[model samples]
Target: MSRAGSRDPALPARPRRTELALLLAALVLLALGFASAEGDIRGQLSGTVALYAGALAGAALALHTALRFLAPWADPLILPLATVLNGVGLCTIWGLHRVSDPRASEAADQLTWTLCGIALCGAALAVVPRPRMMQRYPYLTAAAGLVLLTLPMLPFVGIDAFGAQRWIGVAGFTVQPSEFAKILLVVFLAAYLSIKRDVLSLAARQLTIGSVKVFSQPRMRDLGPMTVAWGVAILLLVGTKDLGTSLLLFGVYLAMLYTATQRKSWVGIGVAMFAAGACVAWALFGHVQRRVTAWLTPFAPDTYEAEGGSFQLVQGLFALAEGGLTGTGFGQGRAADIFASDSDLILVSIGEKLGFTGLAAVVVLLFLLTERGFRAALESREIFVKLATSGFAFLLAFQVFVVLGGVTRLIPLTGMTTPFLAAGGSSLVSSWIIVGLWLRISDAARRPEPAAEHGADAATEVLRLRSG
Candidate 1:
């Protein structure tokens, strides 16, 4: 018998058990976290803690069950990591509720959104059996993405909040279409790049300076896609007045483009274009100017005291400083003092309560999740899967960087939501959907090849044919 055919089938079953075990451990940790957070908030454990734990348990188990049935070979760590991050978000929201006005509590709403996001994630898994299937409709997905991205500009339907016009009022609910649009755009980019990668990778000419081989210039035709992408990104910036989404859209495209073509010039060109766009935006838009000013001198008295200024940024800095190494503990910090503390500044809220150690842990979890995604890309055979998975991974990582950098004064605040940690329905839903897609891709990547079974049969047939 061939060595490939001699492998044990039961080995594949072991990871499934490991997945369940890890999920159970995550559930226990979450339940304890809820109880601890509630005890700290109300000065005693309450029925609300049980309710929160039960809801989280239901959502986690539903996702696990769906994965077991739909993608038995999927990467196991993705679910547990996502669940822990989501649990942390829930705990943070619940903790913040103690300091927020009773009339405006977001804890219950966030829990409801979490459950809904999990349900939608499961639905996505059930419907999309193969990640490759999505590659069939690149233009269709692009159209949907463009529509969603532009929906916030329509009169009466569009709503401006926090000085950014990125939300649309849909049937009485405010939706951030940019969040979901990002994923669709990624799908479109992956499909399009997979088809065009060879041509895009080809160098039309070489530029040499004293035999140094300074540059390999691409064909003029290949530049069309990047131009279109850049134009779309700039339009998003102008139409939405959201630097975060604008940067995210263009950055993700550049990452995917580089992944497809393995060309560094594309990234250089994309960066230069985005830099020019940002300069023009800074010159023309007051909000962009304000963001830059705040980033540069957040502590300046005039800037801090101005309306829509750096007060929130300064407060977040104070909270982080107060948190020190071991934070003030759950429900003990003045996280509510910062505007958008639960969404755009959730990391600062977490840092204030959980301290630097806890914040680092959360960042580590995000890193691991992103690492698993990149691993999926490396393991996949299909070009489309590789590009799509890498794109999604980069998107998540970049969004986190933008959010964290903004809050920490590492970069200007772009009003981006931290995935799984921020309190926003659109972001939460989109994050879970990305997890679902990752699970699908990982399953396909890890599944045992059918050719292994036929190896011995083929060997015998070849021997018989030679003897005859």
Candidate 2:
């Protein structure tokens, strides 16, 4: 195999020295924060600010890795966008503690999680030298993803939060393995599609009817592997009572399949399959049924059973309306009025406090990051890189659409997050990892290749010498 990318030659003379300097500065501030005399929480633990500054320092290092390991590639816009979103998450997490019933030192815990998440992001960048290195463990990665999706089935491992069983409790800390699962899922899909793209695209039948040639509908034989994979994913989600995950995973498959084949027919088939599955799920699963029904008439009249389930959705709308055009302010949203305002309702928090400005800001940043990711995919020559980046970018965009769309009454509330801008360690870390992969693809797509003729003359001379 070819060697990994070389160090960035055009990087400034000082390069990561600046980032290191900031980290050291952050540590010093953190130390002083502990030592400073304090009568209030803010005065005592200026540690929160120091910790976030450290997070920024870590982000710079990851950006450097993008330049080296991914080669010559950079997302000039993505890192800064993530910085703002992560900063927003941290700030919102801190400020909202004014009301959390469990309090559990919300801001301090968030700072701790932010520190942990950043550490995890740095370690991933450190260990995964080349993104393809992850390809070696395709089965293992997919299996791990299955395990994460199945966590809620294991009794005590997963937690039930506002009707979604998405969190895993391990040791002393609770985490959402699904966050990490999403990254590994991308790796597995990229590798799988790389190997199967030709078969998937080529294994087909065609028929001419009346003058039009159309491909035959796929057979169970042709679709066995994909069907099995999709069935397993859906079963895992339904088993775990996580319809949100079910929807997300299905979208990933559809996006990957479409990219690998570039077929418009598959889109129609996919919509059909999705509609069929939804009908099946809604009929057999009461939880899924409840979610759909609640979404259908969150504020509509006369459904006697529509009473309890719409509570969350209505509150989400109320928060958004409260914020109006301009937000209440950075640190002052009345989010506690809604149950579970911290997670699923985080958009509500943004909408209420930042109003249209903050809400618009959140939407724009993710949109820019997603756009850059697709740009990287378009630039990539490697099939896996193209599919990987594009598929994952679609995943982020779709998740945002689902969650935000739901909470804002644009769609049903699927209980998903707003990516990095929401609280939760798994969400935070997975988001940066997504950013890392985007950086990798962007680097590969943009990495300046030495001119194809860089050694042509020397190669000819060497050949002449050898022949002589």
Candidate 3:
């Protein structure tokens, strides 16, 4: 029987040590932060601590309750990893808020968003049955995805953000559809590619390359759907000015396709197509030109005037440059006064305050998560599971590469948040939700006997006897 359905008896379930440790460490850091900021806030620590503590407690309870029920097969580390990173982010946000921008109490807002994201991750973990089930709803998922991708297009619904309409205000709260759309698209792509991988792998004539055989380019039968999908994505992104999401999604599609087939040729073709697409975009799209120019020379702060396009990026570099090694210290950054501080420039603020060490720690956490995710993918038995999970890893790696590189001037400005660490409802929610899916896949691919394995020897012996 699958571990999910096991009627294991004599087991005394409790929180994993890692979960407890995470909460304890987070609570400690949170307490220290509150104490340090007590004089500044003036008798507000009691209230603020109560609020934040309550939120953490509630999030932990919800997550624990979820693992006990829905995804008994899930990894114990996934939720805790998310909680730790997000908790640190919000705490740091609050710290920055205390000094940098007193008018902006981003801590409270970040806490609220973290709770929402935790709730989302918990719910998804609790009831997502299996990651494979997502394949059944590709059409619905894809449609919803398309609507989100087009949302920034509607002036009424979309918020004018960094010259890109990436947000929608519902009632009063803002949401980024592209964040959620990326994951849904991954599901759709996994479903589509799993079925298509075999055909694409088998149907082709071989050509000799330096006495080595290579498959020629895909025929019309092979190219039609992939081309159409690519065109649709490109059209929507170029039209709406959502290049970051578009490039991230397109990169994911190519990575998944190659993973599904183990073909170097597909990657070569993808790179060629990307170069071609970039050339076309640069010629036709003026916005692309500005972004590229800024990426190449973000240090040109004088050239980045109000009328120009590189202001955000130039300011970002200034923030990073100001933050040399040990940082300006928590709650002691000057960059928060800059426009869009909470969104695209959060990383810069982090660099200014947390220094290179803090920045490196955040990156390392992400690297660890990616490593775990890729390991999960490698261990997966089902092709769909492997492709989908690998896609998750690839998406994180590439998205980080995009956003961090953008802020650091390694690439053009994408204005996207640093996943798990950046302050955005869209980024937080989508990242946690993807973690849930990755956890589910990891659990399914591995952990065949979870509840049983976690149980005490005495309890297991009793259960074994009872079963016998």
Give the root-mean-square deviation of each candidate in angstroms.
4.2, 6.4, 5.7
**Tens digit of lDDT per residue, candidate 2, span 1-468?**
033433356552232344345435544543332233121223334454566556555655555554444333455556556656666666665556643532457666666676666566556555765556666767787888877777766777778865667777888778877777777777788878787777777777766788897755555575676567567867877776778877887888888878887766777788898999889988987777767777787765543236447777876787788898987764345675676576778888878866888789788878987887888889877777788888789888988888888887776677787787777777877887777667655654554555435567756754553232
Q: Which stretches of candidate 1 lie over 4 Å from their true place?
A: 1-3, 6-9, 103-105, 452-468
Model 3 bad stretches (over 4 Å): 1-15, 33-46, 449-468
Residues 281-395 of candidate 1: C-alpha lDDT, one tens digit per residue:
8898898888889999999999999987899999999999989998887657778767789999999998988899989999999999999999999998888889999999999
Q: Encode model 3's per-residue lDDT on 1-468: one tens digit a residue.
A: 424747444231333445556666766665665555544445445566667766876786677666766655555666666666776677667766666556675778888888887888767776776666777766677777777788877878878866677788999888888788788778877777777888777676667789888755656587576567656866787777788777888888888878777777878888898899889889987778877877676556554763546777777778888888878765455676776666677778777776788778778878878887898888877677778888889999998898888887777777767788778788988888888887777666654443554568856764563232
Rank the models by TM-score, top first.
1, 3, 2
Cα error, residue 71 of model 2, in Å, equals 5.7
Whole-structure CA lDDT of model 2: 0.68
Estimate the TM-score of every prediction. 0.94, 0.82, 0.87
Q: How much is 3 displaced in model 1, in angstroms?
A: 6.0
- Model 2, which residues run further than 4 Å from truth? 1-8, 11-72, 99-103, 219-222, 300-308, 330-333, 450-468
Pairs that collide, model 1: none
lDDT of 2 at 1: 8
